[model samples]
Target: MITIAVDAMGGDYGPQITISGALKCLEMVPDLRLILVGDQEQILPLIPHNLSSFVEVVHTDQWVAMDDKPSKALRGLPNSSMKLAAQCVAEGKADALVSAGNTGALMAISRHVLQTLPGIDRPAIMARLPVREGATYMLDLGANVDCQAEHLYQFAVMGTAFAAANGHVVQPKVALLNVGVESIKGNQQVRLASHQIAQCDALNFIGFVEGNELFSGKADVIVCDGFVGNVALKASESVMRLAVDKIQKRLSVWWLKWLGLFLKPILKGLARELDPTYLNGALLVGLNGIVVKSHGASDEQGFSNAIMQAYREVSNKSNDHFEAIMDQIEF
Candidate 1:
């Protein structure tokens, strides 16, 4: 059985959304067991009747807040739901962790509890980026603000391995994100990382790729420092919001409203692909355990999607492949 430890009081809505999402996950994942870590009094009432076999509640009086500092969370809150969730993974009592809590605190506590995999200095926040064919995986979204060339190279290997293992892509194309595709373009770190990654025979390391090609399916994995990757991700999210709002206003017209009756089906599918809920899980790879971070403000449906993602990784046992790939990295 695949057991997932969930921080039941981590998100903006706390027990209301997290507990609901965990139950939703159980509905879809039959072979799954969830350890909901939070206040027993709070979580017990939220759990549905006659599901004692599937869901186990681990009581914790402390909870991590969104505004809590990473250092403080790690040093102070020993029995917080988030801390217990990570501890579950560390103790091998859970196959993975699902949390919609403070990202910094989660990372900090996860690192302190689970520790990074051998030869790994830090964990990158990697997530699927929707693209032409299906989706591409990008790393260091907001984990490390500044990364060395070697760090970028490590992201490439890990991202490549993750795509191959999880996305089922053999010889996944990996690229370094740059302003231009030219070898000489980009900062010193990008150039150095590109050269090192290209030398790895195990990876299908293509040369530099421009930002415009991020969602063009030009590469299965794109590697960059956290600052650049985070900025790009936020900017794209903003653009998506702007476009969606404008389209909604435009379609609110009388004639357009009539047209929507016929276009609803087609529009719904498009909307699903573009919606943040469809791609809600951001993985913290390179740790010894599986840790998926859901968007803090995600609704039950979105948070449940994140849980499903954890189920997939846990079922696949992707960590073995990821660690093997990390071992292959020279630096």
Candidate 2:
């Protein structure tokens, strides 16, 4: 059975949303067990009696706030739910850790507790973005802002490993996110990283991918520094929201409302494809243990998706695969 440790007191809604999400995950994943770390008083009432056996509650009243500084939260909050959840994975009590807490704090505490794998200098945040065929995985999302060429190369290796582990793609196509496709287009770091990634025969380096091509299904894995990646991701999400809002406003018209009824099915499918809930989990790859970070503002359903993601990673034995891939490389 796969066991996941959850920070049940983290995120915007606290235990109310997290505990409910944990229950939802249990319903979907039959062989999964959960360790909900949070205040017992708040978490207990949310859990049902029948599902009690499948979950273990680890009580803690403390939790890292969404705005907490990474360093402060790491040095203090010794018993915070996020820290304890990470510890559960590091100590082998759980197969993975899932949290919808402060991203910086989660990374800080997770790195401190679990450390990075042998070949990894620092862990990168990898998450899936909607693509025409399916979804493409991208990395270094808000982790290491000022990254070296070697860091980007490491992100490529880790991102490729992650995409392959999903069982959907074989020898996933990798591309460095750049201003343009030309070799002379990108800055020094990207150019160097591209050359480094090309040296690995195991990686399918397909040249550079620009911002507009993110959802074009041209590349299976896109690697960039955290600053660029984070900005691109947020901008894309904003664009999606803007388009949705405009469509909704247009559909509110008397004539367009009638047309909306006819297009309801198609729109629902489109919504599913673009929904952030479906793409809620982001894995902190290159860490010694699995750690899935859910968006802090995500709802119950979104949090459930994050838990399921962690379960999938555990079942896939992603860390082992990643380590093996790294072992084949000289640097």
Candidate 3:
């Protein structure tokens, strides 16, 4: 059985949505067990009696707010639901952890509690995005805002490993997010990182990829600094929402209203496909165990998907496989 530690009180909807999502996951996956970390009073009542057998609640009095600084929050509120969830994984009580709290706090707590994998300098948050062709994985979403060339190389290595384990492709094409495709078009850091990545024998280095080419499906893994990656992620989400909203508005005319009603389901399907939350959660790569970071605004469906993602990581032993690949790479 795969055990996932979930932050029951972490998201906007609190334990209600989180518990609902976990219950949904229980229905979807038979072997899944959840260790729900939060106040028992708040979480227990929300969980159904039938699900009581599948879920074990770990009580905590405190909760981490969305705006709290990760470092200070983790230090001050050591018993926060987010921290305890991570601690569960660190203590071997759980196979993986899923949380929809402050992104920085999740990353910090995971690093402080779980530490990095051997040979990894920093752990990166990698998210999978649905593009025109298919899903593409982007790394360092908000883990390391500023990174060294070696860090970028490590992100590429880890991202590729994740893509492989997720069955994207063996030796997935890895690219650095830059201003242009040319090797000489990026900043000094990217240029240096590009050189280092090209020298990595274990990776399928595909050279630099610009933001425009990200959805083009030319590469399987795209790596960037946290600042750029976060901006890209947020921008993509905003644009998708705007486009969808505009389409719905334009189709609201009397004549087009029927068409709009007919297309609503199709559009919703597309939106769900593109939504980052539906894609499970971002993996905090380089950790000893898998740790997935979900959006703070995520609903139960999103949380459920994240739990499924944790199950996949544990069952596949992605961390061990990643370590093996990193060891073989000639850095």
Candidate 4:
């Protein structure tokens, strides 16, 4: 059985949604075990007595708020639920750590507690975004806001490794997110990154991808610094929500209303498919163990999927493969 440590107190819904998600996941995967790391008093009551045997609670009074600075919180409260969860993974008690907390806090704790894989300078957060052609895995989603050229190159390598392990085609085409497709269109950093990515042997480094080509199904892995990646992710999410909302509102008139009723289930399915909450979680790549970061507002489904992603990472031994690849890199 693979054990996953979940930060029960991290999200807006607290243990209720977190525990509910775990229960749903348990129903789906029989071999999964969960360590609910939070205030035991709050979490234990939310879980069913029957499931008490399968789910273990790690008591911790400290909670990291959404606004808390990652470094200070991790240093001041060594036993914060998030910190403990990462520690559990580091100590071999849990195979992975999943949290719907502050992204900075998760990255900080993972780095301080779990440590990075050898040859990895810093960890990057990545997510698989649904595109018109197929899903594309994007890296540095928000881990390192200010990154160097070498860091972007490492993100490409990590994103490639993740895509391959998660079933993307061999030697997935990797592209650097840029203002334009032209090689000379971007800033100094992007130009440097472009050169470095082209030189890397481990990745099938494609050239720049302009904002317009993001959803064009041209690349399998998109690499960028966290600032650009985060902005792009947020913009995409807002656009999706606005579009869905408008469609639903427009469908609420006369005969169109009946179509809305008939398409309700389909709409719900589509919403679920495109929901940012569904993709709220991100993988902390370059770590020795699997650690996923979820949105602070994530609900049960988001948390559950995060757990499933962790399971996939552990089962695939992505970290081990990534480390091996890094060792083979010339730099």
TM-score of each: 0.93, 0.94, 0.95, 0.94
| lDDT per residue as tens, model 3, 1-331 | 9899998887778887888887898898889999999999988888878788998999999988888998777798979998899889999999999888888888888889999977788899888877777678889888898898989988988888778877768879999999998767988888999999898788899999889977788889999999999888888777877888999999988999999999888877777766675458778898888898877787777888888888888888877777776677665
Point to the candidate with the largest TM-score. Answer: 3
- Model 1: per-residue lDDT, tens digit, 1-331? 9999999998899989998888988888689999999999999998868677899899989998999999888888888999999999999999999999998998899999999887678898998887878778989888888899989988887898898877468889999999998888989999998888888888898888888988898899999998998888877776766766667677888878876566666655555555433356799998999999988887898789889999988888798877776677665
Q: How many residue pairs clash in model 3?
A: 0
> What TM-score does prediction 3 earn?
0.95
Tell me the lDDT of model 2 at 52: 98
Instruction: Write down the RMSD of candidate 1 (Cα, Å).
Output: 1.9
Count of clashing residue pairs in every prediction: 0, 0, 0, 0
Worst 10 residues of 2 by lDDT: 269-278
> Which has the better lDDT: candidate 1, or candidate 2?
2
Candidate 3 local lDDT, residue 26: 89
Query: What is the C-alpha local distance difference test score of candidate 4?
Result: 0.83
The lDDT of model 2 is: 0.87
lDDT of 1 at 14: 93
Residue-wise C-alpha lDDT for candidate 4, range 1-331, written one tens digit per residue: 8899998888777787887887778888888899999998988778877777789899999988888998777897888999999999999999999998888888889998988877679999888777787778888888898988889888888888777766658788999999888887888888998898898787798899987666677899999999998888778777866776788799988979888788777766665565443554788899888888877777787888878888877778876776666676666
Cα deviation in Å at residue 147, candidate 1? 1.1
